[model samples]
Target: MNYFQPKPISNFNATIDIPGSKSITNRALILSALSGKTITLKNILLSDDTQYMIKALRSLGNKIEYNESSKILKIIGNKNPKYDNIDLYIGNAGTAMRFLSSYLATGTGTATLHGNSRMNERPIKDLADSLTQLGVKVEYLNKFGYPPIRITSSGVWATSVKIDGSKSSQYISSILMAAPNFKNPIDISFIGKVVSKPYIHMTLTMMKDFGASFTLKENSINIVPKEYNLSEYLIEGDMSSASYFLAMSLISNSTITLNNFFKNSIQGDSKFLDVLLKMGLTILDFKEYSITVKGTSSYKGIQLSMNDIPDVAQTLAAVALFATTPTKVWDVENMRIKETDRISALKNEISKINGDFIEFKDGFLINPKPLEMYQGDFLETYDDHRMAMSLSLIGLKVPNIKVLDPSCVSKTFPNFFEEFNKIYRED
Candidate 1:
C-alpha cells in the first residue's frame, strides 16, 4: 500500500485557487450535449469522475474538445443521439451513471450503462422507476434497483412524475435535466423530503442557464420541453474541496484564503462556511470572488443537521476533533452509501487516533480530543477521496501521520497533495 506522509507544520497562511465544481461541470456537460450546438465551459475540472462523463458523452457521438492545460471544455451537443446498443462504463461516478441513464433514456437507442464493482452497488431504481413513468423502458441487466442496467426508449413524453429523493437528489436531477428533452412539459413531484435540496436547485439553475424554462412550486418542478440555448459558461470553484482547507485553517490556528469562490454559490457545501462561523472561526473579509478565514478563537462543538450538505460530513468529522466539546452530526444517513461506508470509515479512523465517537445509523457524535495522538500509524483511506482528503487534516497538527491510498483523491482533486503542500509552511 502506498502512503503519503506530509510533514507536520505549526501554522499556515496561504491562498489556494481551488478547482472548478465537479457537480456543475457534469451538469454542464449534459446540458451542452442536449443543446446540439457548441458551448464553451471555462475552468472545468479534469478528474476521474468528470472524465467518465465526458468519455461517455463522446461514445454517444457528442463532439467535445478539451484543453487540459487551459482547463477549457467545448462541447457540440447532439440533439439527436446516434448509435444503438452502445455500451458506456462510468467507473464509480454516481453523477455520470445517474445522469447518463436518464439522458440516454430520452433517445431512440438501446444503451447499456455499466461501471466498476462499486458503481453497481449504488442504487438506481429510484431514477429508473421514475423514468419508466415517463414512458422510458428501463431494465436491470444485473441486480434489481442497481446499475449495469439497460434503457431502451424511442422517446418519452410525460407531463408529471413522482420520485423519492430520500436516498439521493441525483435521481431527481437526472429526471429534471432530461425533462427538457421530453416531447412535452414535465412535472417532477417529490415523494417525500429531499435529501440534497441544494443540488436539485443547482440543476434547476443550470437548466435555466441553457434556456430551459422551469417553474418551482412547493414540492414539484415544472419544466417546459424546449431546446437548450447554447451559451458560454464559467464554472465556480469547488466548495466541497474548499471545506478541507477551511478546516485546516481552523485546526492549525492559521488563516487561509480561498480564491474563485462565490458568496452566493449554488453549491450547498458552501454552507460549510456558515457552520465554521458558528464554530467561532472569524471571517476576516469576504469579497465577490474570494473569502478569508482566520483562526481567532477556540472552537465550540455544536450539533449540525447535515442532510443538505452530506459531502461535507467527513470534513465536519475532521474538524470535530479540534472542538472543545462533543459535536453531534445528524440527519446524514446517506453517507453510509457513498464511495465507501463513510460513517464506519470515519469511526474506525477516528478510533485509531484515540478520538472518542459514538457511531449511529443516522449520524455520529464526535467527542472532543485535544489533538490526534501521533503514533506513526498508517491511516487507511478505504479508496474514498473524501475520506483521504478530510482525514489528512490531522497531519497539519499531529505528528507521524501517514495517509494510505492517498491517490484516491484523483477521483476529484487530482493534485490535492500538491496544492496542500503549497500551503505547508515550515517554521
Candidate 2:
C-alpha cells in the first residue's frame, strides 16, 4: 500500500492552478459526441474518470483527439452512431456511468455498463427505471437495480417520464442530455425533492449553451428535439478540486490564490467558499476568473444543510476539527452511495484522531478537539479520493499523519498531492 505523509508547513503563501472540472468535462464529452459537429474543448481535465469517458465515447464510434500536455480535446461528433455490442468499464466514475447510460440509450445499439466492485454496488436502478419508462430495454445483468446491466435501444420512444430525484441528480442529468435525441419532445418530472439541484441547473445551462431548446419549471422540464451546436467550449476549473486548497488555508496560517476559478462559476461546489467564509475564512480577492483566500488562526463551527454541495462536505468535515464548536452537516443522505460511504468513512477516521463525531442517517456532527490531543498514526482512505484528500488536513496541525492509498485521488484529481505539496516551504 502506498502511504502519503503530510507535513505541516510553516510558510504557505502560494498561487495554484486547478485542473478542469471532471463534471463539466464528462458532460461536455457526451454533448460533443452527440452534436454531430466537430467541437473543440479547451482546458479539459485529464484524469482517470475523463479518460474512461473519452474511451467509452470512442468505443461508441466517436473520433476524439486529446492533447494531454495542452489539455485540449477535439471531438468529431456522430449523431446517429450505432453499435452491435460493447462492454464499457466505468471504474467507479459515477458521472460517466450515469451520463453514458442515457447516451447509449439514445443510440441504436446494445451496450453493457459495468464497473469495479464499488461501482457495481452504487445504485443505477432509478436511471434504469426511467429509461425503461421511455421504452429503452434495460436489464440487470447481476443484482437487480445495480450496474453490470445491459442496455439495448432503438431510441427513446416515450414523450414523458417521472423519476425519483431524491437519490442522485445524475439521473435527471442523464435523461436531460439524452432527451434531445428522443423521437418526440420529452417532459421530465421529479417525484421528490432533488438533491444537488444546482447540478441539474448546470446541465440545463450547458444544454442551452450547446443550442438545446429546453424549458425548466419548478418540478418539471420540457425538452425539444434538436441537435447540439457548438464549435468551441472552454471548461472552467474544477471548484470541487479547488476546495482542498481552500480548506488548506483554513487549517494553516496562509494565503492561497487559485487561478481559473470564476466568481460566477456554475459548479455547485463553488458555494463551498461561502461555507468557508462563515468559518472565518477571508476572501482576499474575488475576480471574474480567479479567487484569493487567506486562512484564519481559529475557525467557527457551522450548522447547515449540505445537500446542495455534498461534494465538499468531506472538506468541511475536516475543517470542523479546528472549529470552536461542533459542526453539524445534514441533508446529504446520498453521501452513503458515493465512491465510498462518506459519512461512515468520515466518522470512522475522525475517531482515530480523538475527534468526536456523532453519526446520523443523513449526516453527522463533528466536535472540535485540541490539536495536542489529536492522535492517529494513519488514516484509511477507503479507496475514496475525497477521503484521502480531506483527511490529510489533520496533518496540517497534527504531527506524523500518514494517509493510506493516496493514489485513489486519481479518480478526479490525479496530481492532487503534487499541487498540495506546493504550499510547503522549500527549506
TM-score (all chains, Cα) for each model: 0.97, 0.98
How does candidate 1 score on lDDT?
0.87
lDDT of 1 by residue, 32-106 (tens): 988788999999999999999999999998989999899999998887585589999999999999999778866
Q: Considering every candidate listed, which one attains the maximal lDDT?
A: 2
Model 2 lDDT, full chain set: 0.90
Quote the lDDT for 269 in model 1.
93
Badly placed stretches (over 4 Å) of model 2 are none
Error of 2 at 70 (Å): 1.5
